[model samples]
Target: MDPKETYSPLNCPKPVAEGIWIFDGLMIRMDLGPFKIPFPTRMTVVRLGDGTLWIHSPIAPDEDLFSAVDALGSVRHVIAPNSIHYWYMADWLERYPGARSYAVPDLATTAKRPFRIDHPLMDGARFAWESEIDWILVPGTKVSEAVFHVPSARTVILVDLIENFEAAKLSSPLMRFMLKLVGGLDPNGMAPLDLRMTFRPKRKQVRERLQRVVDWQPEKVIMAHGRIYDRDGAQELRRAFRWAI
Candidate 1:
């Protein structure tokens, strides 16, 4: 999927899954405004096999995006996986008042300021989403508390663990320097330079967490920061965080 075509001039197209669909975002460069970014952000819409839709991550502030999401099946839940991502949850929840909000425990309390969070994610816990998506908690990230595994695509959806960027065009000195330092412009960007030190103490935990991830033997890794890994997923994950290997 070419970023420019898939999400460029327009917002991410709706992706229909086993009852789920994805409404990606407008790519925004730090220098370029939201509409002018050379890249885009993708939001996930998980419709459980039961027809209950779970909206993950935040959506753009545009009215069209909001209207599009409303057109989907009944939204039973809204998730702000981590602390830093709840900014858009308020609008979404307001629009769909019937949908209950859930967040990581730490974020749940704080997220209350904007939305009514009804559930807190627990580590090692498993939740039966749709027949197609089985979610598990990956408790080491500072913001997000879990990652999702989609067995059908041999895909593991990680909100902040690994990110695959198209380095060719994003290789500009500014982008490179920034990515090499603060990490990417989004949550799943490769380990930020700051997180490297923070994650040092949790190295073993992170490794063990990944071990469980490997148990899934995922083929595609979907990260929120950059592009998705379609092949050699395991090796690419190891390379994403050098310490994990």
Candidate 2:
């Protein structure tokens, strides 16, 4: 019933890089085969060169949260980086009608509700962020995720590709164990066991894509569902994908 138990001090925007911030929001449970798992929600906002926001995996929004976000800049581009993470896109667009939406193409069929995608999350589209942000699609999953590298900030933003749930944040040993069973335990987190399996058939493609990310030499890595890897990011990226790479 309490979101703070999963992600505390909610509805606040915390800075990640000079032009980037992360907002923590509601708690949610996702079904992983037969198990229902609890996870805290996080979203990233990048103030592009035009001063409009580039949101990735938007969290549930409240008026207050919207106002705080508006102060950062006009909400211009809302993104559903992957299929499963598109849940709250509708809530966001309803408030910022001027904001254009973009999502993974696979979402057209996977989404339970109709999601408006103004563009595909593709690179070389001449997006405003091109000078600062480079992107690529991490293939080999039903819920294809788009990963972004902000060279100016040395940050890489991700949704669902990795989950590093900190042990101290969980209230129960059982919950921690269950989370670990899904490969979400901190310091060793990668995508959940089930998600990684999806890459088995295309591990080479996944590995090649991940290696390109590792070469970015990121200094900070941000995740939507767990702790942020704030240092040694490129190394962390390599370690997390070690199993398949």
- Model 2, stretches more than 4 Å misplaced? 2-4, 122-126
User: How does residue 111 of candidate 2 score in lDDT?
Assistant: 91
In candidate 2, what are the lDDT values of residues 6-84, reduced to their tens digit? Answer: 6667777899888999998888877756665678899999998878888888998898899999899999989898878
Q: Against the true structure, candidate 2 has what lDDT?
A: 0.84
How many clashes would you count in candidate 2? 0
TM-score of 1: 0.76
TM-score of 2: 0.94
RMSD of each: 4.9, 1.7
How high is the lDDT of residue 201 in model 2?
82
lDDT of 1 by residue, 1-245 (tens): 34532344454444533444566676654332222324445667765667777777765658787667667667787877765557677887888888887777777555545667776667654455646766665445455446677776666666656544555546355665555455544323465554455556667776777677777777666665566666666656655656564
Alpha-carbon local distance difference test for all models: 0.61, 0.84
Clashing pairs in 2: none
Q: Tell me the lDDT of model 2 at 187.
A: 81
TM-score of every candidate relative to the true structure: 0.76, 0.94
